[model samples]
Target chain A: MDVQTWTYLLVIVTFALYIGIAIWSRASSTKDFYVAGGGVSPLANGMATAADWMSAASFISMAGIIAFAGYDGSVYLMGWTGGYVLLALLLAPYLRKFGRFTVPDFIGERYYSKTARIVAVCCALLVSFTYVAGQMRGVGVVFSRFLEVDINTGVVIGMVIVLFYAVLGGMKGITYTQVAQYCVLIFAFMVPAIFISIQMTGNPVPQVGMGATLADGSGTYLLDKLDGLSTELGFAAYTDGTKNMMDVFCITLALMVGTAGLPHVIVRFFTVRRVRDARKSAGLALLFIAILYTTAPAVSVFAKTNLLKTVSGQPYAEMPAWFKNWEKTGLLVFEDKNGDGLIQYVSGPDNELIVDRDIMVLANPEIAALPAWVIALVAAGGLAAALSTAAGLLLVISSAISHDLIKNVLKPEITEKQELWLARGAATIAVVVAGYFGINPPDFVAAVVALAFGLAAASFFPAILLGIFYKRMNSKGAVSGMVVGISLMLFYMLKFKFGLFDGGKEAVDALEADWWWGISPEGFGTLAMVANFATALLVNALTPPPPEHIQNLVEDIRTPEGAPPAGSH
Target chain B: MQLPTEFCRLSGPARMFTFSGHTNPDNMDQPTRQEHATRYWNANLRIMAVLLAIWFAVSFGAGILLREWLDQFRIGGFGLGFWFAQQGSIYVFVLLIFVYVYLMNRLDAKFRFDR
Candidate 1:
């Protein structure tokens, strides 16, 4: 079938599956809404978490980043997956054992202060909001391209689908739908990778295909060839660790910690029954996520290799129809720089014949003359990824507002039904705000995602870990640490993100586009995390410890128990 | 790394508290609190060190440093180093979390410390 026909059928089928899942898993009680009654199987929760964790950015933008970053992009590969280790090891089970509905609950009660909870709430909202914006933008791009609809219409449709499932089902609906999405996205992601891998190296597995020798028995290593090709076309060495090593290290560290701290990912652990289950679920979740993450770079390499082969030396006007199609969307564009019809897709220090880097992955199958159905499947996959993450993030915000702020703090006596309405209302409002931001994403989706991670790292990560492992951490410490940490990272990011805090985006947009002190915005969170740790420590030392009951609760959460008999509650 | 085995000797809820119980008098004493805090911090530090070590070895050691040497070999068209940096490190990271989950479970059981 043609791409248009495929796009229509896939979107209809996908939407129907999602709505059906939502109806089947409609959440009634507050417990059902928030934690899915804390009864999700480890395997089920793993699937859901994988879907939640791998956002539109992962499916659509990561390959694009790697396509360009080349060897230096290892930071993304290491930093992103490496964060899950921190999550499963240091954060997940402990939080699960605590059995709270949200991250702010642990922070608020542990510190025994509303200020700490409020600080945490703000930080959570900020990270989640920024993240949701990226997802919305992803949805918009997919709709605009495949459906031939306006980008805003695509975003609204995605929001509606997510709202239908998320409002009725809450975590329960999102979880199951996400499982389906995980399958679609991973299948969508891997099929193309495998195809390209086979075409390039006679290998069906993408991971193997990435490092395999160049076709035509070129004798040089695949990376060496890429490096040669890149530099030859006036780009940096493909495999050199040429960045400011310190900044790269920091960014990677920040992302690892930030990922661990994200509330949506952490709350997934709570869906499992026991601490042991939580651990198992985390491991499984990572494995499922890895099915795609591991394949992303391979896809990047394959796509890059294909482009260099197909278009690098060819005349721009003679470029394939796919090129013109993507350019029409403005996702990819060329200006005949120096009046030359040849288009060079290299990173230049100053020249501005710009192409939106995200176009590489979105246009991969098309670039390779793959079947139109694959392109349609990609369109569907992008929508799934963005919508799933957006729903998950929206739920986090609404849950925080209703569960932590409204019920837990402001009115502890609120009924479950009332709280449920408030949560839904909060979720709906969050979607509207996110849609607005989606209309004008502050930057490329991946860059914005990195900034969200940085904020999350600075604010929540140290607090959550400390609450689990440190008895002395008080409210004063947590409040101060999160406030300072998030603000510091925000100041740095805002300076470079838009014309916001310091020099405008243009000042940083020049060829000297390195982040402050050479720390790319993606990696700056590590420095902020350290700052959070130190500040929390110092303030905790100065402040008094929480009440006796609070300490006892902390200790109680540390111990695991045998599973209680089912249906006993 | 070996932990302070005797750290869990205290009975009842004491095992739940990571450090000396909260310092509310009609509360656990300072010496006990200091001991537990020190022990808890040590265990957490040990775990972090181990995980961090593995992390660096995979990404920096295998991915960047030894990538050249490993690249002499190939899997399909991909060099071993390229695989590790792009794909292998992530696989190892997933394994690391499971390993950590396993190790910490044992530690918690031994210390009577996990919930």
Candidate 2:
């Protein structure tokens, strides 16, 4: 079959499978809706968490970003993965022991204040919305490119599928479907990578193939050859970093803390049976994620090497059909500067070819002349990634509004049945809002997505960490710390990233040299998080300690035994 | 640093006392239960501190701070630092979590806190 036919068949089949799972696992009560009735097995929860955590960006764009950025991309590779260590050791087991429905529930009861709960809900909404908008956009982009539909129509289709599961079956449905997604996405990512690896280095493992000599009997290592080609073209060597050391340090730290704090990821642990399961599931989740994370840099090396060899100094008229296909999509552009027909794929202004970073993964199969079915599989995989993450984020957003706001703060006397209806209603609305953002994304959507991590790092991580570890952390301190931290992060992000203080988007690039402490705005979360820790500690010193029962509650959570089944309270 | 020895000493006597006659933790007095809880909490903290130190050493120290120096040494075609930044640290992180799980479970059993 042709690529188009294969793409339609695979996309339809996968969507049907997800919808089938959703129907099979339909939630029956508020507990089922929120935490999958807290009976999820450790292995299943681990796979579900892996699917929820690896978003569209991880599936589609990370390898491409690494291909272009070279050694500097290590910040993302380390930053994204290291947070699991924090989660497994410090956060997950304790949060699971707390046995609550939502993150704000822990904040509310631990701090013994409704105000703290409201603050947490607001922060959760802010972070999840900013993050989900990008996922929705990712879905739209994949649909338009692969399914040959309008982007808005694609977004509507995505929203419909998510609403069907999330509004009806809730977490139970989402969990099982995400497991299916994890399988689809991992298989899709590995197949093309293995094929390209063997083609390039005669090694089946992409990880090993990246370091091996070329299959053409060149007797030179792949990295060494790439370094030579890069330097010859006036670009930095593939193994040498060009970013400032401090900036890399701070960005890695920010992303790590942010990952640990994300509500969607943390909530996954609550679905498991016990504290031990929570810890074990976190390990399993990381193991599953590392399969792709470790292979990405290797994919980057292979793709980059392939791109340079195929396109550099080649005649535009003689370029492959995949190159022309991508060019028509407007993601690849070629200009004949000086009226020369030869493609000048170079680093500087004289360069005549412009390639979008996303094409590395999206076009890899086509570029390698792999089977048409594999290309279609990538499209389905990208959709699965975007939809799974979107469903997870939507659940968080809905829970924040229905469980945290309406039920807890607004009307505590509502019946469980009424609350369930409200949760579904809230989810439906969240999906619409997310779809709207996807269809009519603001100019800053792409830029603001990274700031969601910054917001999570600044606001949630310190609050949740202190609430767990320090028995004396009072509501006043937490409220003050979160307010200061989020405000500082927003201020830096606006001033530097959006150039709100100086000029607009056009001037933002020029403002880089004036960065505070040589750290980019993307890395400012580390500083803000430190400020939060300091502020909370200072305020706690002045305020009265938490009530005696609250300290006892911390003690109860510290022990792994006697954790009430999640949501039993 | 002194925590492991202190934990060992405390746990040794505590285990003996429990085995003698006080197997039912629910019957213990408030202060005695609080003491048991404190010992368990302290042991958990010590383990966290040690594991987190190794986590920092691998990712931040080897991966970033000493990356340039470590780049002089190559494993296969990868620099030691580059491998750590991209591959090695992630593998170590997975291992660290399992190790924590194993140690904490044993600690839970020792403290009679295991379900």
Per-residue lDDT of model 2, residues A453-535, tens digit only: 88999999999999989999998999999999999999999999988889787889999999999999989999999999999
Per model, state how many residue pairs clash: 16, 0
Model 1 per-residue lDDT tens digits across residues B1-115: 4334343334445544434333333333323444644455567569868987998798877886687798788675456786788888898898887787787777766544554
All DockQ scores: 0.38, 0.72
* Candidate 1 CAPRI grade: acceptable
**lDDT by residue (tens digit), candidate 1, A1-569:** 78999999999998899999999999897777888888899888888898898888888888888888876788777877888888877777777767768888778877778888888888888888878888888898889988999988888888888878888898888889999998888878877777777777777987776777766676665666777887887887766557776666686778778888898888888777887888889889989988888888878877887778777757787988887888798876577666667766656743434657677778898887788888888888888888888888989999999988999789989888999989888888888888888887655555667788899999899888888778767778878888888888887776766647555667667524656677776777888888989998998898789788888767655555443322121
Chain A TM-score of model 1 versus the true structure?
A: 0.94
Interface RMSD, candidates in the order listed? 3.6, 0.8
TM-score of only chain B in every candidate structure: 0.65, 0.75
* Global lDDT of each candidate: 0.78, 0.91
